[model samples]
Target chain A: MSTDRLRDVLRNSTEHVDMVELTDAALKQSRQITVRRATVGATLAVVLLAGGVFGAANFWPKTPGDGVNVADSGSPSASAPVEPGPSTAEGGGEVTVPPRIDGAFLYVTENNGLISWKPGSSPKTLIADHKGGEDMIFETANVSPDGRSVAYNTTSGKLRLRDLATGKARDLMDVYEGNFCGTPAWTPDGRILITPNTEGKSGLFNPVTNKYTELSFTVNGCQPRVVKQGGVLMVYFIDGSVSHLRGIELESGKVVVDVPNTAGSRRATDMSAAMVTADGKVRFTMRTTTLNGTLGDGLRGFGGDSLFELRDGKLVDLDFDDRTMGAAYQGGDGLMVLRQKIDGKYEVSIWDMHQGGGFDTEDEPASLKDALPLGYTY
Target chain B: MPDIAAEFTEFARTHTPSLLRAAFLITGDQHLAEDLVQTALARTHRAWRRIEEGNAPAYTRKIMYHQQISWWRRRKVNEQLSETIADTPSRGDSAEDVALQLTVRKALLQLSKTQRAVVILRFFEDRDVAETAEILGCAQGTVKTHTFRALGHLRKALPELADAMKGNV
Candidate 1:
């Protein structure tokens, strides 16, 4: 049977959810007004910080009395220029993006402990304490592709980069880690760390040179969907309508292809985009849109976003309730989820792609162990 | 307060079905699913301060997962298991219930709780190992093991699924 047949069987099962009932439940607990208030409030707070708190938020000492000496470090920038990674990371000196994501997932204990899920049948092992203080309000945490490195920030702004491979750590100060970030991505070259800001900017921090460089802004207010395209760090954006894709150069702020916006919802064709990895040829794009919020923007309330992927010239389109945030695809390899269906009233649901576009099964396993040897134990 | 009430009410409305489904999977009782939803909400309400805006879905899901696990553990020690599904259609008689769904659910129950959790997290939730690991509170390896074992159990229970899962795997 064709692959579509199996997917159909999965989606068409009689025991599926009742969509109406689900929507009823979601709307029951949700409020349109309060969410707007909170959102507006938060945005206002950000605005305040950007204006008056700038000197304090961006370039000030932690304590009120302790003055910041911009030149105390006596360096052009707090971070030095990270020499371009060797030709390649493994041996060539430059860091190479891994074709696939492989690593163990570690969890911090409820209070202050760190637990690791290693390979094999063994239970989780406690790795360390938060050293920061139990007041550790669950800051951001990230793991490297090989699972040998993990970095996180504490309730305090102190940044901690742990070498899982060596059990050592290098601390970076004044990080201001927010809830969104875990750690910087380790490029294939492994020499520089890459981070994208919601405001359409990318940051490269070179630990070796202690220098930091900000890449030209590409996409903002959304996760700059990252994928390894053509051995280069590529991020793609599918416009609001899923039409028009542009590849933006992070370093030089170049738009490779200038894709125009889709004709709007009135048009039958919706534009979406995503990344595919079979061979090494993909482009990093920073897409732009042209539509404005007229009345539909404020009155219709929250906007929506489609999580799409472009693979083999195919656009896998998915939808999200939160239009501001982008979908995250890990490891730049193997079976990137193209689109997910959202029931009315907003529930995140990724359909069974193999089963002809339906929700994922409740009984299916969580890992890809059936296909590849896995590194995570949980 | 009105907005909070509205938001809470909305959140309860939309996610209640899935939450009920999840609660039902763990509790094996409809009454308990209702109670589980209520219990989870009380905690969710308390967490509203921290979850006011950002990633509310993720925050709520984490709460639901923890609440289910807690509900499972805190209940009275000795529990009774129901052998038959309360509502099931006869096999040859396809009019009443979905034979496939019932069969899958039955087979799913055969595995241990964690295995079921892994299966649901991996497939149903469509989360990567890191995300799944976060939800299950286990290592990525455990997620993999549970997944493989769950699949193996499913196949042994229903070899017919092999045809459907073939290319996708």
Candidate 2:
């Protein structure tokens, strides 16, 4: 029909509509939405206020005579027997005591030492500078799953654990004589440390019994990330140009799940990191490209480097882009600890995979201050 | 002090019928149309102070158009369209007009979302090409192409409507 006739038909068709009733209904809905938004805003404000108060109460120093000791290890010569009450400093200033680092914390390697950081507190250097020589590196340290102990390959090729509470370091094993290459992956129960040994083999070192057992499987040039369930390990290896994720049953050295050519491209897949979930599913971040061109070059070109999870026995894209640099499975909650590049700085964030599967950064991303360039674990 | 709620309510009271008609044309479902209008109005109410008094209808229309497209893109399964047309009169309406309306509605649904939006804006809303392009966030040439293709689809779907247009011209 003609444009004018079409307009007339559309306009006339609405003649029988009850405009007043629709308006009332719409107004009510609008008001309801407004009320809901206001309520959410108020609730958020109250929650933030409560959180601030709670954080201050928990982290703030107690007043003088509050029966708290402020110990300074560096000032050992001034080790006076601390009374039950808080004492004033020699300079007459109220002594401020550092709060104990509790809950899950991060152990980051600095130049040659390790720094421990909790969410609300400042980072504390647990290990002093012991820079690596030509054949030994002291920075490849792994924090236990419980965040209690830190195990590192020393410059002298000794595997040592530093008790965070006692600030003492003790040798666990000597997996290598020089140049320890592989990182220590801690099991879920914190009982075993899976260390990569010489000659493309892996060894399980128990700190309690000082017993070391070598595995039969060879994971040459690959990092073994352990899953929480069933002693399964997600071993990432690159053979020639193709990358593979092999799920190995730790006890029997049996390969259960094998995914060859992770990106399903003939091109080389350069896998950055992989983490296994509690349910034994593997999630990895990698970049794949053909010989000459970028990622979007081949037939069935998946976009640039993104996160993918092995779901239902196939690699499924998680829609995350290259901004995510590293991810660690946050215990059993289906939430992952993600290190993302935001505004040119690598910031730590928590991504919820269970609820709609995206990074929920409404809160400010945690800063990776005083952290080593590469090593971080959750 | 002017009551924002009262001002918004009065605006809705005067404009709900036309807005509902536009939403129905966009979504082709009565319940969905009501939902679109409500969502648009709620957004408009939230931004009532920032929007100029004379531009409330345009602002609400923009929200409804964009929201409809977003919902269409996000939903995996297409919802079944209701067979009963609420706007079509039952007793007094001529059967020919009802049939023609039904055919036009069906033809409109067959067009892609952008094409359907172009058709409704160009013909029913009487928007110029440039205005429709700006509203649809597309180039003027793209709007013209969509309008041409939509008209071609409608003419093919309803040859009788093409003849009626020719006779009217």
Candidate 3:
């Protein structure tokens, strides 16, 4: 009877629940999840093959009159197989730094400090004892559109810009107190879109002139992605119980495209970072959690990330194989995906959204076996 | 043979009431309880084919607990103290029963999320320490510790319910 009393109390607590409404909401969310899974499975065969032709060609040493060298300084040939770097134990291994991929230098945080790594060379420490002493620099640090500077926020709330050439760092603004979103996004025109301030004021900040232009409209989102042709800024933000992707026209400041997540399904689709194509196609990385014992034993903790592209206002999977691709950058004519191969190698392949073709393999000067893609030379 | 959707709908309709009751006790908020149940069912629907022949309700409850633990922590501001327990003449409950239920509900919410889950599993669901630990993906020792601490808090908060809670402690 005592046990019944407790059970009755618990049952009475839910007496007000509307069963029909709850069932309908659950069904709708289930359909969305099904759609997401099917979309991902369909795009599996649409693989970016090995050629590295379009944007990756720029990483190789160009013959005279080729005029293609951007971040090129390594001796690795385009076709020759360079030996893999000496391996280390899983967590304590040596960092395999990559050669300049597509003229872009990667800035990563190791145990020592923040290091700027180029192809065929060792990682040079840019800042010793940096404020944010974690590998999370890869999440917040973005290479400028020109690849001349890297902008990263410190744990102390200081947004600092480190020049790749001079290695000098300076404070842009103190945004630590505000609800500063992660990863300060760079506009195509080379200005950084600072996450909105506490007052909901966002602006385009020109790092060179140290000038800040208030955006025509106030937008709220984290991980803002912009296309090169720049009509709208794709912003990802969670409002209350749902996550949304709203395309705000840069000029009018009006929301042009609004993709709201289903109610009561926040964890089902966690859009951490997104990439916007010139034609307005958006691909985002969704982080899903594993259902501990129920799902599987191997997938106990974080249920790794899945790449999804927003098509016709629905999220389709963008992953082709087991290899996980990082944030894509606008290359010459298409988007360049930096894919980590299953055999412990890195491939910088150009994916033409319209055309399907084979990718050419080019050997990176040093293996970026443990590096996170921050930004690239565009 | 019903398709996945049709089968899932029947499953959702049948199990949603118990899921809602458990979720309401776990979250102590009607809106969050509803959301928790929906989210759990959504995930259950994803692995429906895999778990359809297996224990679907257990899988759903596991998802509900895990999701609620991760979610309510982030949305701490929205966690409302549950309303007073509704009086039911059909249950033959008196005024003291209502007060005791209200006290138990409020006291349950006061414990940490993990402790609250442990208490609910051990007492309400009648799960042993091993089962509670397995459901929570924690060690049996953790469940025992949480169980001891939770019952201590409950007995301290509701002295009237102390005799009923004796065996568990």
Candidate 4:
């Protein structure tokens, strides 16, 4: 319509608004917000100050390359994904796999309970048999952002941190039975975000000092992402039949934006992986999960996941077709989506969010298929 | 001074209708419009003392527009336009007006969320370019660009209403 007619129609439409109902709801929610603020204040009182003493210190000693583990394994095939098998090296019959490609680097869980990877030269064994456990014992072994540490969960329900340089694995905390801390997402500054219970008592656990800061709000969903640029902790939860994607501000612990998936809309019903793009926006995948499905595989869900970009507080469909089980990583200047074919082959799709060029897919290692970023946990 | 609770309630009730009109235009859905207004009001209540004396309506409008632009949330279904408006048609309204309203709503959804916000603030709310830019937290140049693009989109989407508009915008 003409600009004037558009204005007239909208102004006249307000006659239909129920002011009393709207005001009441707003007032009630405002009261709840006040309560939440109070809760955050109370929780802050008990935050362990011991971790702050370290003050963002590197977990490993600084070496050349600014402590970044660029030690590349001498495996002839550099692009091959690591597979489970017996070690080929002739030293006391150790079983090991090629280092998994994490962005431009790599990491691997040794059968001897060591989380270590050397990037450029022959692999460096941090310690000789520091602990005894099969490779399968360590679930969700994720390399840290600085490539100096690995955060993993044991099958015995312990959240453990392994220093790749020292080969020391320390227990950070004990998780509840039947749940593994395998879904830990690392912040940009390298603190592990773990929801150790079903009640959504999530918080950031610093591996350097093993201190935890409980979040003010509970997150019922797994795979919570802390987008530093957006300053919001993005989460996905289901409220009845409607799935909700919310951004909780990290500093204030306030939910700044909430998008709900309503029936008949193309919005995400269930979200999968989320990663901050080069332009500082979070991109995630959404799929519908059936009751019969398992939470393993990071809730890959039925019919695969479709890509969506969070823009201007709305979920803009990225028009990506799916079966995308895992995708996230800041590998290059573009955003990456790792998709797996039904035949078990994996490929990477890179899309430039600001630029409108469609994504380019190239065959990639299955190791790049992770729910979190390349160096983050499953 | 009046009771803070009562004062806030009165403020909410007084401003909600006008807020919903702008919200409805931006969201293009009756339910989402209510949600946008309510959320903004709730935030305004938190800062009530600070803003109550210093233009609470503008503060709340800024929150509504900013939240709509920068926040991330899951999608909720859009309720049918006919269902909400049928019961409360203003006097002298005809079927043609209703049809036009629905058509305009549909056409508005075609634009990006930011584009729609620019159109609503500039046209529906009669906000000047600077005011619209301040509310949306964007540069004035962005508002002008979006306004130009949005008007072109609307004209194309609603050709029957395309008769030359007398409005300067």
Using lDDT as the measure, the top candidate is 2
Clash pairs, model 2 backbone:
none
Supply candidate 3's per-residue lDDT for A45. Answer: 15
Model 2 alpha-carbon drift over 4 Å, by segment: A1-110, A128-139, A178-180, A198-200, A229-242, A264-280, A287-305, A311-314, A330-334, A343-347, A356-378, B1-169
Off by over 4 Å in 1: A1-115, A126-139, A165-167, A177-183, A196-201, A218-225, A236-247, A256-275, A279-307, A311-315, A318-331, A335-378, B1-169
Clashes of 2: 0
The C-alpha RMSD of each candidate to the native structure, in angstroms, is 21.2, 14.6, 17.6, 21.1
For model 1, give the interface RMSD: 11.3
TM-score of model 3 (first chain only): 0.56
As for candidate 4, its interface RMSD to one decimal place is: 10.5
> Candidate 2 residues A1-378, lDDT tens each?
455666665555445443434666666666654444344334444444543344322111233322111111111121111101111222213322111101233434345555655444566666555554522223356555444567766556676777755666677766565534565655544456677654436767655445667776755433345554333333443332234455566666777656654443333244444555445556655455543444221111111245667777656655343233434432322334444332223444444443322321211124444453222322
User: What part of the reference interface contacts, as a 0 to 1 fraction, does candidate 3 reproduce?
Assistant: 0.31
Maximum-TM-score candidate: 2
Q: Recovered native contacts in candidate 4, as a fraction? A: 0.43
Tens digits of per-residue lDDT for model 3, B1-169:
5498888888888998878877877876666778889988986786677664757887788767765554223234133563323332224457676566667777887876778888888877778888877777667998898888888898799876676677664
Name the lDDT of candidate 2: 0.52
Off by over 4 Å in 4: A1-3, A40-378, B1-3, B71-74, B77-92, B164-167
Across residues B28-137, which tens digit of lDDT does each residue of candidate 2 receive? Answer: 76667787788778767766886775988887786676555542221311344445353445345577866767777767777767787887887778789988776665
Q: Which of 1 and 4 is ahead in lDDT?
A: 4
lDDT at residue B152 of model 1 (Cα atoms): 77
Q: lDDT scores for all predictions?
A: 0.40, 0.52, 0.52, 0.52
Better of 3 and 4 by DockQ: 4
